[model samples]
Structures are given as C-alpha cells and as structure tokens.
Target: MFKRLILFILLASCFLGHAQTYQVEKGNSKYNAFAFIEAQKIYLKLVEDGYATTEILSKLGDTYYFNDDLKQAQKWYAKLFAHYENQVTPEYFFRYAQSLKAVNKYEESDVYMVKFNTSKGFDARSKMLEEDSNYLQMIDFQSGRFEIANAKEINSSKADFGPAFYASNNQVVYATARESGSVLRERHTWNNQPFLQLYTADADENGVLGNPKPMSNLINTKYHESTPVFTNDGRTMYFTRNNYDNGVYLQDKTGTNKLKIFRSYKNKGKWSKPEQLPFNSDEYSVAHPTLSPDGKKLYFSSDMPGSIGYDLENEFTRSDIWVVDILADGAFGAPRNLKDINTPGRETFPFISKTNTLYFSSSGHQGLGGLDVFTSSISPSGSMGKVVNIGKPINTTYDDFGFIINDDTQTGYFSSNRPGGAGDDDIYTFLQLEDLREECEVHVVGNVTDHKTGDPIKDATLVLFDMNNNKIDQQITGDNATYTFRLDCDQSYILRVVKEDYTSNEEVITTPTSSGLMRTSLEIEINRIPVADCDDIGPLLDIQHIYFDFDKFNIRTDAGYALLKIKAFMELYPQVSIEIRSHTDSRAPDQYNELLSEKRAQSTRDWLISKGIDASRLTAKGFGERRLLNTCANGVACSSDEHQLNRRSEFIVSGFGEFKDCD
Candidate 1:
C-alpha cells in the first residue's frame, strides 16, 4: 500500500555489494530479500550483543520505517541522529523528520526539516515548507470533504489493499496477503506473510464488497501479484507482479527480484498468459498501473533510471508516476516521466478518473504526514495542473494510497494503513461531499441598459466592491453594453454603474457556494439625471426600499447599495443638503421605537459621511410610529408585509438653494 515498500526493495540491492562481518552480513541478506521483519530481529540482536554500528542503526531505523512502525522508527532514528548526525547523510534527516511527524512532534520535525533543506538543495518539499508554514491549517480547511467507512465484509486479518473496479461485472479486484490452503505455500519474509495474490469480490452500487474469492491462477502467481487495472470492456488487464517468466522467477545480477507490469487478455471467460510489458526492465521497478478513461494511456509508479529526485547516494531512492501511450497496434510507447508531478519524495498509486483528474498518493507534496492522497487535473494534451491535497479522513499520519473514484456517483475507495483496521492495510470506501480542487471561482457578467427605453447603454463605467465597500475591480462597458468580473464563490458584492449624464445604479449580488465554474447574469438600468425646480424638496433617488432588520440599525449589504446611490446624487449636486430619515414599525414600545429609529438614522448619516460626503450637507432624524405610510399603526393587527413598509430609510432633498439651475 505504501511506495516505501518498493523503495526499500530497490535499496536492498544497493547494499548487496558491500562487505561486512558475518552477523551484519546475515542481517543484510535478510534485508536484501525484502524481509524487514526478520531483518529487524537480526539487527536488534546485533545491537543487543554490543555491536551497534551506524550501519546497523541505520538499517534498524529503516526496517521499522518501511514496515509503517513509525514509533519504533522514530526511536532508532533518534539514536542514529544523536550519535552520528555529522556522519549520516541528509536522507536520514529527512526520514527522521517524517517519522517525527507521525508522533505529532511537529516542532522537532521542523528542526530536522531545516537540516534536510540545508543539505538537500532544490528539493520541492523543503520549498513547500518554507512557503506554507501553516500548511496544517490549509490541510484542515480541506477536511470533511469526504465521508469514509471501512469495507469490513471483504477484509481479512492480513494485508489487503489496492482495490480496482471491474466495471463490466460490478466486481472489485484487489491484492491480499491472506493464506491459501496449499502445502507448498511460500511466504514473503518482508512481513512474514504469504506472497500477495489477486482476489475478486462482488461490489454493490454503494461499494459494499462481499463474497470474496481468489482470482484465476493465470493472473494470480506464486510470487507477489497486485494493483490490477482494467480497460472499459474488462477484456484487457494490466497488473504488477514479481519478475517471472516461463515458470522461473527472474532477478538482476544483485539477486533482487524487481517488480514489473504485465498485460493479460480474456477470451471466453479465461485469461491468457500475461506478457511482460515492453517497458519493464531487469534493473528497476514498474508497478501500480492505472488506465485512463479512453484506455489510450497507462499510468504507473516506477523507480526506473529516468525518474527524478535522485539523492547523492542513490538514484532509486524515490519513485515517480509515469505515463505510456497505448498504441493502436496493442504495443506501448516510451514511458514519459511526469516532471511536474514528481518531487524529491515518493509519488505512486496514480488513478485517473473519468473527468481527467489524476488522484495519487505522495510524500513529495505538503500533507499532514506520510503518503497523503493528492489530485491534479490532467489536460487533454497530458499537461498537469496544480496539485492539491485531498485532505483528511481520507488521509492520516499513516500511508494512504491506491485511490480510485467514479465522479458521477461521487463515491470511491482508497487504501490506508491507519489504526483500527482488520489488517495491516485496508481498503476504505468514501462518498466525496465536495470537489477535491481548492479554488472555486464565479464569473459575474451583466449588461447596462436605459431604464425608460430598455436600450443598451454603452461607455458606462462599472466598479465592483466587496461587502466591506473596498474597491475590487473596475471596467468600462463596450459598445455591446456588456461587462464581466471574476470573483470568489459564496461572497456578496456590489456592482455600481455610472455615466456622465445618467443617474448611477448599484446592484447587490451573491455568488453560489458550489465548486468549479459558475456564472451570474444581470441587466442593470439607470436613468438620466431628472430636471427639477430650484425649490424642489422631495426624495431624489428612485430606490424601491432600504429595509433594516427587525430592531438593528447597522447597514446591510442591500441597504449599503441604496446608500451608495444617495452618496452619488450628493456628489452630483455639491450644494444640495439632504436628510437621512429612518422609520420603525409599531411592534415595539413608542419610546423604544423612537430611540431605535434615531440610531438607524445616525448610522445612515455616518455611512454617507464615511463615503466622503460633507457632514454639514447631511442630517439624520427618526420617525416613530407617528408617521405611518400604511394603515398598520398601534392597536392594529396586520400582515408582516404591512409592518415591513414602515421599516425603511429615505434620502430627501432638504435644501437646493445654492444650485441656480432650474430646468
């Protein structure tokens, strides 16, 4: 389930050529054979006998680290760093940092991260840490997007992971280390468990798996076999297995059996012999295969020669995701490393959804801890988009990987080695409550038109402001009277349109709270400044109504829009003085209503003054139930709408004597 298992397998080969004492050589042989549990026992015995060298300490730490025993890994790594800090390489510092995070010692982990950054120059993980010091808060913001549950029915008391959908039969195929009843069964010393074998289980629409059964022997081999991906038709399959050919297990000169991908076909309900993929090599690893929606591309994790993020000591210390084109003639094109998606740590178990979104597990990207799941958009031309962590509940301090999903159902499964599972690794089903992408944007588009004739008003200036009245963006309407602005989702904004001869208009709009691209269209209308007598004293702005809450005086977003209109009119007639009159309904006591209305009026006057209107030009007054616009007065029971009519604010022209023009 974790890519480190593969990485350790590769690292074991590098240690084979070194010379050591008899006891250390015996422990190294066990470690080289993917036997971490036995290797741990041997190394511990060596230390117990007073032979604790740096090599023994380093291998002791790595054995536990690769086995997901981070607590034990942290203990030995602490010893390794305490005595041999200057002697060990930078990777030990990085590994110690990762192990420290598993125990929630983030401050201690950060210290080692600083050391790793100082030594491992140009590593993206260090740069990410520098840029997002509060990365934990960012990951927490993306939590609760998924509801997850363990698939209990198909699980056993062993390692079971790498779930893939066989769409044609509504079955799930996965790898498990459960024992099969065979006298000659061979066990992998890696975890002291039986070799992995592929199994199938019937899955319901809700992803509940049952009736588990072993897959055909042709596809399941005596050596490790896992991580199978199927094409749409289900006749063709690609899976990972130990390098075996013609009934013999194959290994390179170092005597380490590497993993390779193999393709098989089904005919008449039987699977043909799997052929090793052309890209597989005797020197490196290729595993965890996934197919694109069109079945024309194959994605897998590899630690091959061309993989990025090679440390000074070893070239295969990390794994990366690679893609190969499925040629029309049923052959594979050369594999291309996903440069944009790779980093200095492991990236593996890639799953491509129907929407061209790539979901994979990574230790290279910023996350809560060990291999966390992340998503990136894959363009039609195979370019990668920004990578985002598919945050927690799906990911934890332990390894989480092998993610797959059906976008339409918003349901999927992923593997995790976190606590409370029936096995070392288990598959969990989840319903995604939100999209994995972190950014959500809404586009506001509208047109300006004449209020009377309903004609397009060109050359109008449109300004956008947030709820706090801070200017965000501005633009001028073109000949078509259209304007647009991009804004964040689930926020309220005010759009003000103005022209030289037309009365300015303001409209309040709120965007939707959903993910992805959204659009809102509007048609705003404004009228030319009206002509009036010099002594005219009445409401000048044609606002429908500006209503406050039941007893509150603070300005609401809608009320702010109306108030901006009044401010604009005052700017037009600089010498005009206006009164901001506020009213209250007859529900409260008369004295209480009068005081509340006074506060409302003062709030409106203060708001206008804040917008640069001269205080001497504006005055505020409160009208209690004494001035009723309708028949809803004291002792009268009326509908809510009738009472709402009285809860209003109006801007009236009190004096215009300074303006001599009377048109």
Candidate 2:
C-alpha cells in the first residue's frame, strides 16, 4: 500500500488565477491527484524546455523519490540543494540522505543525516537516526534461507502488485493495470494505464503463477481496484476500489474521488456485488485491504482525519494503517489507527500472517530507502511488538512491499520495484529456511528448595537481573516451587531467590551463542543462617570446600556456608580488609573460564556484602582456570573430586592482620 506524495499540489493550487503555461497546469493537475509517474514525464519535459527553476528541480526529485528511482532522485536532489541550500526544507535533507544510502553513499549520507537531525531536533525520524546511528550493521546479515525468483508467467509489462492467496485452491488473486475483456476500457490518468482490476490465476507447486483473468463484471468497474484479501474459511473477500457509482465517479466538493474498502460475499457459486464499507468516506481515501488470520478484524490504509503527518491541505497527507473489528453479525466497527506501527510517514500494504505477524511497508520509519517491508509480532490479545526491518535481499533500497506469507509452508510472495525485477513492480516468491527462523526468546525456568530438608520452598521471591544489576522482573514461586521468566537475547542474567528464614541465593545464567529459543533450568537451594560465635572466627579461618561447577562462578548452597565464616570474621574485625581469589578447572576455554572465575569472585564479594560486610573491606580477582592446587591441570587424569578441588575460592587478609598463604 504505497502512498505517493503530492507535495507540490498545494503549491500548484495557490497559482489558481495566476498566469501559467498549459504544460505546467497539466502537470500540476496530475501531480495534485498523486499521478507521480505521469507527472514525472511532464516535469522532465518542462526541464528540457529550459524551465528548471528551484521548485521544478525539487518536484522532479520528489517524483523520482516517490517512484522508487533512488539514483534519479539523488541526481535532481543534488542539483536542487547545491543551488537552493539555504531555502530548501528539512524533508529534502532527509530524502537526500536516504537516496545516498540507496546508492551506497553511506559516509556522505551521514553528513546530510546529521544536518536533518539538527534541522528537526525533536522529530521521531531524527531521534531514530541518533539512537541507532549504526543501524546498517543490522542489515548486513541476511537470512540465507530464501531462494527468490520472479513469477514471470503471472507478471505483466504494466504495473502488477498486491498478491494474495485465493480460498482453498492453489489459485491467487492480485491487482494489475493490464487491459481486460470487460467493457470498462477506461484508463487511469494517474499512470496513463488501464484502471487496476482484481485478477485470479493458479499458482503451481514451484510458485510459478499462470496467466491471470479478471474477476466477474459485478466486481470490476471503470475505476481503480486492487489489494484483494480473503478469509481463511473462504466465505468473504475484502478489496480496495475507487469510489464510483453506476457510470459516475463519486467525488467530493474538492473534485477528489477517494479510495474505499469494499466487501463481497460468496453465495452458492458466485461472488456478490461488492458493497462499500460503512466507515469509508468521500472526504478521504481508504485502500490496501488485509485481514487478520482469524478474519475477526480488517486492516486497511487511509488518509482520513486524525493523521499525524502534514495535512492534505498543506501538501500530501501521509496515510496510516487502521484496523476495524468484524462484529459477530458481520458488521464493521469504527476504525482505529495502529499507532504502534504508524508514524507521521506513510505506512501501507499491511499483511497479517498466520503467526499473527503484522507485515507492512513504511516510508516514515528509518529504512534502507523507499518503503521497506517490516514485521511486528502481534500477541494473542492484540498487542503489537517492536517493528523490525526484513532486511537486505528481501528489501532493497527500492519500494519493496505487499508481503504475504504462509508460516506452515514457509513460502510467500511480495511485490517490489527492486533491481532485476521482471517489470515495474514484479511478484517474487521466497522460502524460509526452517532452521534459521528460530525464536529470539530466553526462558529461565527453575525451582527453589530448602538446603537442609531438600524440600520445595513455595512462595519464594525470585528476582531477575541483568549484568548491570538492574532488576528486570520479580515473581514468587508457584505452589509447585517453580518460577519462569522470559528474557531478551544476547544478554547475561542473574536469578536470585529469597525465602523467609533463609539466606538469599543467586545463580548466573548466560545465554548461548547458538540460535533459536533457549531455556535454562536451575535448582536453587537457600540455606538457613546459623548464629556465629567469636571462636568460629579463629586466626587461621581456613574456609575450605567453597566449590563451583565446571566453568561456573555462581556460589552454591554448600559453598555459601564456607563463605559465611568469612562474613563472621569480617564482622568481628571491622578494620580488616580481605582479598578474594577465585579459580576454575582447566576444562573450558581459557577466555571463557577466566570470565567465569571473575564472576565467581565477584559473587563471593556480593554475598559478603549481603551479609552486612561493607564492599570497601573486600576485593576480588580471578585466576583464569589456572593455578591448580593438585595435579588437576590440563591433560592430567583426575577424578571428579580432584577436579572440583581445583575450582575453589580462597580468602586472604590484606589489612590489620598478618596473613600466611594456605596450601
């Protein structure tokens, strides 16, 4: 659902009674009606005729920009900025930057992006650029699963777009500007081509589609029609068409015939005459229809009232994708904007997949170039997730949109004007590599238990924290003593459990570098603290058996007891400073084991702090899985107990006392 800008329409209208040549007036008329391709031809002619004013150059650049011709847009934008640098708007700066990126002029683009941010300090687009200045890094990695090919048999030399699956059968329904056998041979002045019509064709197992034929005369008219979407049950169909009645095109007082969403029901063996949606109006346009997987909601694009971008009277009113409830009686509800995905820029061609993923194309959000396809997860309750670009080959710096996918088959189609396409806008099929499309979720599932009794500790508080010690989530264990938390990926986490009458215990859980969703299971045991006596804090407080798992730094329940004695000694002598040395068995990589050992040392110091010892009184360091006490070094045969002895923690007094190293 691409919305071509008619930015110069308002400027052209202001010259109503003023003297202007016929070519300029004709071009302005087409431009005002969003006929950018035709307007481009007219503007280029005027440029050849020696009428290349600053406004003419800007308009020419916009025509190419809206048409997804980034190279041509960049050429004109460069000339316009060079001559009218002090007079141009910030929007041109942003478009110029995007054009530079499309042509791979990244370093040069950044210079203009900085200028755009400075010009519009508080704009969302500006803020987005500032926050993720290195966003190109995210696009470099491609999902190597897709093998894309043009559906050449189904394509036409004219504009072909908005591909959708037909009901139950292997057939697909799409929109095209090709001539039909019907009597409505009318041409759309917008592009000097036949008005778009809904066409159906069969798609083979290999995704090559057959030549398409137009739908019944009842649905086709002498007006624009496109974006046909069907329900899963194949009972109803929703599509986009211009507002026309009988032989007359319905227009508002402003001479604008707006687009509208229409519904057609299938009865017996035939499709009923389409009916205009109740929420549609002549004052604004509503087009590009898509339905949710359940068919309980309808999503479409509109430039009606309540849009955030520049109003229509000023220039181009950027359209927004909106959804409406399909009531139980098959009636429509009032429309609501999808604010989570919509920006002040144009967002169109929304395709809701079987997995409840809302796919759409946008010009407002930061992207590689013109409308880039993006996906956002929709929860069961209809909550929208963060939007992420589909990236690289699937999305070029051109207008790549109208996405449709089948999660089960992992195959889908989308329309694009990207390089190497069959024509102006061609349909391409893609297959997802099942293994590569893994979920980016982390689940920490664990049970808390009492140390001595080894019984489940119900209702224990569990807190999840990041490496920075910031609390992410907190929950109490269920009656079964199990707790679960869903965490983000590419991050480190710590799980701490606390029970009444027991000391708090913490464990580190690191996510693996491997792809796909992961779950980490832990058995946390919190011990009951015992009252310490001064005699327990002897001069040689040899805390032994402070153990760690292979390549793990988190303190265990048994090891917490050995550290508790050191906590008692610290409380006994407030002036004493202690240094903690942690080690790991030589079973893992040196770099990994060293990091594990350091975390273990820090965990020991944190435990002492939790036990009322000041952090200033203690320091910690790791010995990188090195310095074995016995013969448990690398390549040495040893029992499990011998290896465990090597992964031990040691405490050394550094202040207010004479200390001797222990063997």
lDDT of 2 by residue, 191-304 (tens): 566788888988888667886888887888878889999988776888998888566688866787888888888989789988888998988888998888888999889888
Location of the lowest summed lDDT over 10 successive residues in candidate 1: 531-540
Question: Where does candidate 2 clash, by residue pair?
Answer: 1-349
The local lDDT score (0 to 100) that residue 74 gets in candidate 2 is 96
Each prediction's TM-score versus the true structure: 0.63, 0.62
**Local distance difference test, each candidate:** 0.83, 0.77
lDDT (C-alpha) at residue 656 in model 1: 68
Per-residue error (Å), model 1, residue 555: 65
